[model samples]
Target: MSTYQYWQVKFEHPDEDEEELKAVIQGLFNYYEAEYGVRRLTSQVRDYYRLIGKQAPNHKRVQRLMHEMGLKCTKYNRRVRKYDSSKGPNGKKGKNKLNRRFMSDRKYQKMVCDITELKAGNGKKVYLEIIKDLATKQVLTWAIGQHTVFCK
Candidate 1:
């Protein structure tokens, strides 16, 4: 069956005023009063009902109403930590061979190498290794592999 029909069957008789609740939800999201998602918005709506001495609506109903109105919280859901300090210092750490000099008078005299991973649409990651000439600003050579471990 359709999702709308399922929800309708589940909530045959809703408790709260759906129109008013939609307005409250939209106001909460549009005004940026607080970081709100489904769970937080549900509690805030319940608090509003409590303050008005009326019965609060169920969270599922609120969620359904919010979905219908296309009101959503745009807050970030995850935190990304860039650096990891757990690994021990390896002996392979090398010094700055270029000595902060990026320019080169001759072609291929100075080059920079970098490796990065690209995610494909088939859920597989492809690693690429690129060598670029610093003086000419051109890519010299490149290699792509499914599982290329450039750093030990």
Candidate 2:
């Protein structure tokens, strides 16, 4: 037989076992809501085979299958944009007296203050205001509350 004919016969037929394994992987991927990456998926697949009394496929094989099937975990892949304070009009810009020199010989010589927003366990937004000393790398003061704006 010609080399072309032999190649066609060898490569044309898909493995039945591989098809079933791909189906299993797809089912697991959906069951976890696409949060399982290759490592976790491989572990789950191994457990599944153990439950069924069959030998589990190699992790590399599972990875290759996942790549071919275009499966990916979405949890860590999400991009969250941070809040930018310099974008809108508000107050006069503070002079850069520090001139980017963050280091200081004394604790209170170079201090910085910032406000951060955090989410509570009940899904409510909490704002935290903190003052820190750059020399000692310690927090001087901190306050937490629900409102970002304060009125006198």
Candidate 3:
């Protein structure tokens, strides 16, 4: 066939129906809340095709389509380290006066304190310290500050 005839035939009969495939991918991606990456999406697409008794598309094709459609997983890739109070310079270790006996018959006789670090909605760090009565399980005192020095 001549070049013009080949071009006409190619245009008339495309190798793959990309629009239909893209629609299916978009539906599945939305159905999954955009958590499925290319690998899982490709597997889902294969399963869908198998269910319909049609040939499954190649993984590379699925990946390319997802890239073109700007679909990406929302999950973070980095490991977020939790707050550790003992990571820095060592302070004089205090004796465990409670000795694992948290029960108390009288109020104010035994109390426990804890410090927690929190992130505000504006991305600012906030520290919260709480002192509680062991017997009543009530917060005796609580303080919130921008710095850890408030605990002192």
Candidate 4:
């Protein structure tokens, strides 16, 4: 026989207690599948027994049962990293010509360039490069293409 079958036959508990615990664990697992992890599920199980006035099982026991039954809360909150402006592998750290001065005496003296992504209705990826004249607040030139080489 397989190891699982062997273990099941060798160390079987009384039918009443085993079935009741299994049913309660399954119910709680289904109820909290979206939000609760093992820790919260353990507390919920304890709360359940407290309401029914029965002896609550240990949290580690609940965690073990959850592992055996393949019950898990897959969604976890994650923090996104902050965006950095000067991060790349171009090997050229060119000086900022504008020196953070947005205002310009002449029309094209201090121009700003930016590349933005565009999502079309057909789901194709397109990139748009825009050059703006800082003094007049007008677009000097704009180009759209599938490749980012337009910016380079």
Find the candidate with the highest TM-score and give its number. 3
What ranking of all candidate models by lDDT puts the best one first? 3, 2, 1, 4
Clashes of each: 0, 0, 0, 0
Report the Cα lDDT for residue 71, model 1: 71
lDDT of 1 by residue, 1-152 (tens): 69999789768965456667888878866666446888988888898889999989899988998888877666555553232222225624556789899988899898887767777789467778778999999998888877654432
lDDT winner between candidates 1 and 2:
2
Worst 10 residues of 1 by lDDT: 80-89
Per-candidate TM equals 0.42, 0.53, 0.55, 0.52
TM-score for candidate 4: 0.52
lDDT of every model, 2 decimals: 0.74, 0.84, 0.84, 0.74
Q: Candidate 1's error at 149, in angstroms?
A: 18
RMSD of 4: 6.5
Q: Write the per-residue lDDT of candidate 2 for residues 1-152, one digit (tens) a residue.
A: 69999789767987888899999999999999999999999999999999999999999999999999999998767675453333334544656778989989886888787778788999567878777899999988888888755211
Q: Which stretches in model 1 have alpha-carbon errors above 4 Å?
A: 1-16, 77-81, 85-152
lDDT by residue for model 4 over 6-125, one digit each (tens)? 789757754575567767888987887646888888888889999999999888877777777777776554443332223445745656766777987787787777777777788566
Off by over 4 Å in 2: 1-7, 78-114, 118-152
Ranking by TM-score: 3, 2, 4, 1
Pairs of colliding residues, candidate 1: none
Candidate 3: RMSD over Cα atoms?
A: 6.5
Task: Select the stronger candidate by TM-score from 1 and 4.
Answer: 4
lDDT of 3 by residue, 1-152 (tens): 59999999987886567878998999999999988898999999999999999889999999998998999887554455454543444655566788999999999999887879898999567889888999999998899987665435
